[model samples]
Target: GYTVHTVLEYNYVLAVEVNGSVVGYVQTEQVFDSAREEVAQRINYAGAGEESWTVEPSYQIAVGEQVLNENQMADAILESSSSEIQSATGLYVNGELVAVTTEGDRLRQELDNMLAPYQNPDDPNLTVAFNKEVRCEDSIYFTSTLVPVDEIIGKLHGEEQGAVYYTIQSGDTPWTVAGSFGISVDELQAQNPDYDFNSNSGFPVGSQLTISQAMPYLQVKRTLVSTYQETIPYETEEQQDSTLPMGTVQVVQEGAEGLAEITQQQVFYGDSSTPSETTIIDRVVVQEPVKRIVAMGQYVPAENIAYLSDGSTLIWPVPAYRGISRWMLGAGGKIHGGVDIRANYGTEILASASGQVTVAGYHWSYGNYVVINHGNGYQTLYAHASSLAVRAGQTVAQGQVIAYVGSTGKSSGNHCHFEIRLNGARQQPRDFFPNK
Candidate 1:
């Protein structure tokens, strides 16, 4: 079907068809030593006494319906020669040959091995066939597929977004550099595909590392500020004790402002004199009708006290304890039973515990008192109250407002007398309030 003409110095052998057409050619010298020698010897014998053998140059061939151009044909011939060389010597380029060695015969052999099956046209099992239909005049035309060059180029370049640049500085490592800019090591590698951090010379100093900027979501918050005012009554105790003339002083009628009488006395002598040693005896309140009154002993300084035990001490039932006639319990005499919380009229009184209101009405010496029996063997009394909001047997929670502070019965001034009794025994109120 075909004849081969071996060329000596050119290192090529030509395959000629029966019609004297040169089908293809291979490089014989680039193949194996034995094949090259045999080809050279045969050529010498065949052309003995002749100037040269007439060898047709290579021509294009139609493999299937697709035509292989000159360059593709030449590549195919080179690959075939490399394959033959590999099969003969069990090595690409036949080891000592120089022609195929310059053209990377080992790499060609690898590619040939990879593409060998697709190169064969005669073997049905080795070839892959694809049919494409074309429209003709009242007929269907089928031809082999021709892939466009642009499509091949497009396939070479894959789908991916581009990269950004970040400069490297001192104390920078691959991990730290990527982490500071919020990028992954894999992404960094993809951005600069040629980066070789392992090699010292690959990424030089002052070089930029390409990365992608990271984006995140956020939220907003609002704040505000304001201010206001209120009026509260103020009272201070006189520092000293003194007596003033108690005769009825003339009150000023309408449109008359009275003048205040001034008097001072030495209550403490020499080095013993202090600010508390003397007290104000009389004071005047200037108004539409001016009035004046005599003041006696200064009120005691109010100090917050705590009981040493586990309960609160109660306030005495009387506003002032100077008039206590007898003691109800033992031989303790007519001593004051409870402390008085001096509050202005209508100050709210709170319940000490969660309990039911046992007594909320009036009593002889106790006045308009309310007694609450707490369930845990504890009871509290609020006496000298102006009014009670809770009724008898009504349930009350702890810290609930029950009444207002007032001087209702045998009391001298407006105050709340609070008392706490545990299992019918009086206990000090300061024990429960450690900070007071």
Candidate 2:
């Protein structure tokens, strides 16, 4: 058996002593099968004072295959194992071993879910098979765990295409949701067949919206035929009656919607989650539409009907008003829905046209305001007032003093925020004041 020993070069030696007296020295490279026996023999031959050895300062030594110092041993270990080891997952497709996920098996579930939506119950040939294998993972201290589902599905579906879908939330618009998905508003509208951005109030809350980077999955062609009953809405016809006063309408008959049968064949393509194409094969209208009729009267006394001319007209609402403070849109071109006219504080706010006061009181953004209904389906509004001279349902003539303009609620300064409405829908105020 070998024994532990301190090593030295030609310039350095081990001092030997016996009986507390220095005697001779031994080189560090000199190996001994037995250190005790070797040291005793040295002491006896040199007549040392004590059987002991002294190592000089700054001496280096090795214990077996390792350095004696902790730091030196650590440095040796690091230098031997400096190369990085990678941990990857072996990917298996359709039970046959395929490529390896450069990252790891953590993304297995994500890929599985993306393929789930494309599965077809009618077609048994379409299927998805995927799995992961972990091997030689000893050296990797940190591993990548996430792989975007879109990226994985893109590979299987052919080409680098992806999809993003989300549920509609409160305060979400087509523009906003499209932006969130990194697509244009027009593209989003095209993806959905039933949603009409211009006419719709907005997407109903919790409805799912899909945005795809490319066509999804294999093309699945199928045909469907069905027939259903549809509602044929009633039509209204007006008959003039001289006996009834003008602006009066009477329903002579109560009309109802008629039923109609419709049968058609359609060709559908792609998965149920998001169909790629649909074409009508045939269509037939089994029942004809019915018409509805209504009667209107004409005969108005001149004193009762107010008119500036044959058509409706509007006047400046604020007396002693300055220029237009703000247009019908805000700073960033966002819809403000009304115009703000600069006026003196508490200046008399006059009616823009002869009308009945439909609304008069405090409003959220308009503050103390008044809305006048001008019998001809036209209306005018005066907002941000200090006091009101008219109450709801009160009729007033054109240019009549209705309220005083002031900064009451949600106003920056003294101004009259004016708006013109037709049948409860806001219209351009300038359109009614063509000569302004």
Candidate 3:
């Protein structure tokens, strides 16, 4: 078959090829010169500048017979002659290659400059790092996506069609903002620190609330691990006082809540709507809880609040268990609802307090578990059991073998999960066994 372009008078064209595949053809000298200039301008980049060359420029150049435009010819030239251009340093955010730059040193300096404000001089513990998995890679890039540092910063905070804002309404509040956006107040406060949320008047109406943040592009995660003091709520303990008037109460000892020293790990994210994770590493009671004793003249028999476990009533359910692995509220401040006692598989799980077996069956989280009701608003639960020695509604005594430990359900290893409930509220089992 005779080629139509070959028969034409101006048949000689610049056929651009990259590694063997023809990208496009430059039919005119003017198109070729313009394309070459554009390609040179695009590839000759300095990493120190604001323009970021992130990923390779995507090309859609038609091969042969098709007349290439300026952009298309430029794409062809860039694709064909990349070895003459400088290599681009890629910036990967959270494992996704986002941007590239030729000025690697300048990019690194800019990133450092971006994160410099997060350092706390007064408290040296304040450490800030990229929340996303960020890394720099050196490779050849075709990215002609040039932009200023500000736009690149916008990219760091996630540029979803720019930023989104919520206009304050007649009854808009921080709490309401959280409800409307399905976000927490902490996240909202983090996003808008300039707003005086703690002021008595609060934010005025018609204010623009930044619902979606446009903060530093580092996607920063600021962490502070410190030991702080927190107040421990005082529990009221009532007793019979014959010296006081009848039907009247008096505080014999001025009740005061104690203070506890806690070592906690706190994490905060910038430019993200995600909630922060808090973990309690260790806690020590600086002061114990004081009971507000009130004396009533009308003498009535006192209810046995601690009859089942008198602050030391419940016996150790797993005698051969190694130790407690997890405590109530141990997982990042989330409710664990129980204490995990590390033990050998098939180890005997004894009843902590004498009670009737209320439930002995399989559960999604508990696996083969047993629940014992001690008849006095007190209940003990043993979970992740391999087998049950007692059935539901059966009577069991303290120290009696009720089940055996196993890694079942949501359990990670062979262990006995124990829980103590007072009037259906989960209590710290550590309080029941003071000595251990």
lDDT rank order: 3, 2, 1
| Residue-level lDDT for 76 in candidate 3 | 55
Question: Judged by TM-score relative to the true structure, which candidate is superior, 1 or 2?
Answer: 2
In model 1, where is the ten-residue run with the lowest total lDDT? 134-143
Please give the lDDT score at residue 109 for candidate 3: 76
Which of the predicted structures, 1 or 3, would earn the higher TM-score when compared with the native? 3
Best by TM-score: 3
Task: Give candidate 3's root-mean-square deviation (CA, Å).
Answer: 24.0
* Error in Å for residue 167 of model 1: 99
What is the TM-score of each predicted model, taking all chains together?
0.25, 0.28, 0.34
Model 2: per-residue lDDT, tens digit, 259-295? 7666655444544433333444445555555566666
Candidate 3 wrong stretches, greater than 4 Å: 1-88, 139-160, 165-219, 241-256, 264-282, 292-295, 298-436
Error of 1 at 13 (Å): 99
- Poorest 10 consecutive residues of model 2 by lDDT? 134-143
Per-residue C-alpha lDDT of model 3 across residues 7-124, encoded as one tens digit per residue: 5544456665555666677676677667656555555443334244322323333334767776666655564555444356667667555666676667777778767777677887
